[model samples]
Target: MNGMHRLLWAFLVAAGLAGGLAGCASTSSTPSVGVGPDGKVQNPVQLLGQLPLPPGAAIRAEQSLIIGAGDNWVGRVVLDVGRDFDAAYRFFLETYPAQGWTVVSAVRGKNSFMVMTRQERTATFEMVDGGMLAGSVVSMTMAPRNAAVMVPKKP
Candidate 1:
């Protein structure tokens, strides 16, 4: 694999995504996914429920929110990983798919980005070199897949 690809996987490692790197071998694997026992996945931006982040992931509490929407819940958490860009990038690339998410688009380099979807959930990830601290900043935004679908055109 190329350097970019390796880093994405490293992100998985340093990000503390459960699956091992070997499990990421088949990027083509398509596993079934659905809402958790709570009726829905609390984390829309991540591949699975609130992922177990690396040792130093500090969640920006004031910026996060979980609100009730009818019988469902909507929320987002802004977390920063205390690692270099490569390590965190690799974490998501490998972890998301292993958890049953389909990667829609992925770009790994100085400025990295990943967009993935699973069932009615969609997550957009961005890794930047600088943020609140000296390490890399991982901004993950998640929402319902239907939230961004195009409106049907009139016949």
Candidate 2:
């Protein structure tokens, strides 16, 4: 077509692109939803009022889900421990009891596991060592504590 028509067509295409991008951009009145701008829980005390988390641990929200809130929460919370596996392992070993969790079972290795109980609930920790660079991943699952089952003695 003529130069004037081509110029008008280019301007229209640029305006359309700008409008589309503006539509895609989101602006919120608040700083964040459930988490802070940094993706960490905005209020850990409100979310995990009772449970103790390792220092500097980042919650993997995409991989984590919970029911209830605060001290009554249940479900799995996957954490990216910014330290090595041993550190994360010890953090739970030390913190759980300090928070009133009685250790039912604890095993340490390349892939560690620990089970703890408090009041009417139980927590299971599945830990994995992610080598030197990747740090460790701690998957904590909390549920209601079960009643003990009796077993017969062997003759």
Model number with the top lDDT: 2
Please give the TM-score that candidate 1 achieves against the real structure.
0.55
The TM-scores, one per candidate, come to 0.55, 0.68
Q: Score residue 61 of candidate 1 by CA lDDT.
A: 49
Residue 152 in candidate 2 has what lDDT?
A: 35
Lowest lDDT sum, 10 consecutive residues, model 1, at 65-74
- For model 1, the local distance difference test gives 0.59
* Model 2 alpha-carbon drift over 4 Å, by segment: 1-33, 36-40, 147-155
User: lDDT of each structure?
Assistant: 0.59, 0.73
Assess the local accuracy of residue 126 in candidate 2 as a C-alpha lDDT between 0 and 100: 92
Query: Candidate 2: lDDT of 46?
Result: 58
Error of 2 at 82 (Å): 1.3
- lDDT by residue for model 2 over 1-155, one digit each (tens)? 76543543354445446544764685623223277676666555555657878888888777876554568666678888875677778889998898788999998888999999998988889999989987889988776575233343558
